[model samples]
Target: MRDFSQDIDWLSINTATIRKQHGQEVALNTLLDQCASAGIRAVSPWRDQVAAVGLNSIAAQIRAHGMALSGYCRGGFFPAADAAGLRAALDDNRRAIDEAKILDAPCLVMVVGALPGALDGQAHYHDIARARQEVLDGLAASLEYAREVGMPLAIEPLHPMQAADRACINTLEHALDMCDALDPDATGALGVALDVYHVWWDPKLQQQIVRAGAKRLLAYHVCDWLTPTRDLLLDRGMMGDGVVELKKIRQWVEAAGFRGYSEVEIFSERNWWQCSGEQTLQVCKQRHQTVV
Candidate 1:
């Protein structure tokens, strides 16, 4: 594994990690400036955040800062209630691919949706198998466009807890299965974005990481899983603050030939979000060096 102790050359901050400061949304431009000031060479900003600030302007700012994107925030959520909804999802993803290309991101991370309207407290369908199938079809369609545009798609498998509303693909194995079915050649066009917060508890994590190898492992996200958790979606712990075996997993990832940024992607609603962006970023840097 590469040593992060000396410098943060390989560290990338996902904007969501510090998107909120003192429980308020910080502008993407301000966040970019803060990242550059902190000597963070890269970031992964969400589509909505980028859209809120305007795409071309943000691209210019990123260039001025000389920053790189580890991956794009997302381009999935393919499952929907109807045919038109599915098509809209595909259209949205195509736009996301274009945005990712504009930002020069390495890959567009995917959080494939599940159970349609489940997130809104009323599921349109309860058939998970149907959702998984829709995800596969949607991904296959999206992959065609991604290939045409020369942008890689990294499917981020949410933890199983998120399967009902966020992502139907809940395991690294399942993500890779889709990759194999779609890309088949490990061509780097289709892959997986492995997030420690989501996959740390899996018993087959190391084995699956090995199975993913380097080609399929397009991006890696780091954050701890809080014990006695409060919110499933927002209560992610900072590195070393929880029980994830950070180094060991990195070792496995590196051994399998993944040499990418260790992107810090925390969604701490009550803790880190309550702090200033500067403090949250400083802690991210420190924890990344010492523990991660």
Candidate 2:
């Protein structure tokens, strides 16, 4: 594994980690400035945040700050209740690809959606197999456009707990399978974004990472998983505060040939979000060197 004790050259912050300061949304431009001032060389910003600040404006700000994107916020949620909905999802993803291109992101991380309306406490369909198929089809179509545009797509296999609403592709194995099926040669156009919080508990993680290898491992997100979590979606712990074996996993990832930025992507509602952005960022830097 690479030594991070000396400098944080390989570290990147997902803006969502500090997108909220004192429970308020921080503007994308402000977030970029904060990251630059903190010596963070890269980030991953969400589409909504970028849209709120205007795509061109945020791209200019990123350039001004000399910051690169580890990946774009997302371009998934393919499963839907009807044909019209599926078409709409694809259209939205194409636009997302365009936005990612404007931002010059390394890849567009996809959080493939599960049953439609599940996030609203009602699922349009309970057949998870159907949802997975839809994800596969959507990815196939999206990959065609992504390849043409030279934008890589990183399918993020969200945790199983989020399978009902967020993503049904809940394992690294499954994500890699999709990659193999869609981009048989591992051409770098389609791959997986491995997030520690989501996959830390998987028994097959190391083997799967080896299977993914360097070519298919496009993006890596890091955040500790809180024990006795308050909320499934928001209560993420900062590095070292929770039980995730950060170094061990990174060792596996690095051994498998992943050399990209270790992107910190925590979504804490009760803890880090309540603190100042500066504090959260400082802790991120400290944790990056000492623990991550």
Q: Candidate 1, TM-score vs. the true structure? A: 0.99
TM-scores vs. true structure, each candidate: 0.99, 0.99
Best-fitting candidate, scored by lDDT: 1
Q: Which ten residues in a row have the lowest lDDT in candidate 1?
A: 223-232
Model 2 Cα lDDT, one tens digit per residue, 237-284: 999999999999999999999999999999999999999889999999
Clashes of 2: 1
What is the lDDT, from 0 to 100, of the residue 143 in candidate 1? 95
Please list the Cα RMSD from the true structure of every candidate, rounded to 1 decimal place: 0.6, 0.7
Q: Over the full model, what C-alpha lDDT does candidate 2 score relative to the true structure?
A: 0.94
| Span of ten consecutive residues with least summed lDDT in model 2 | 220-229
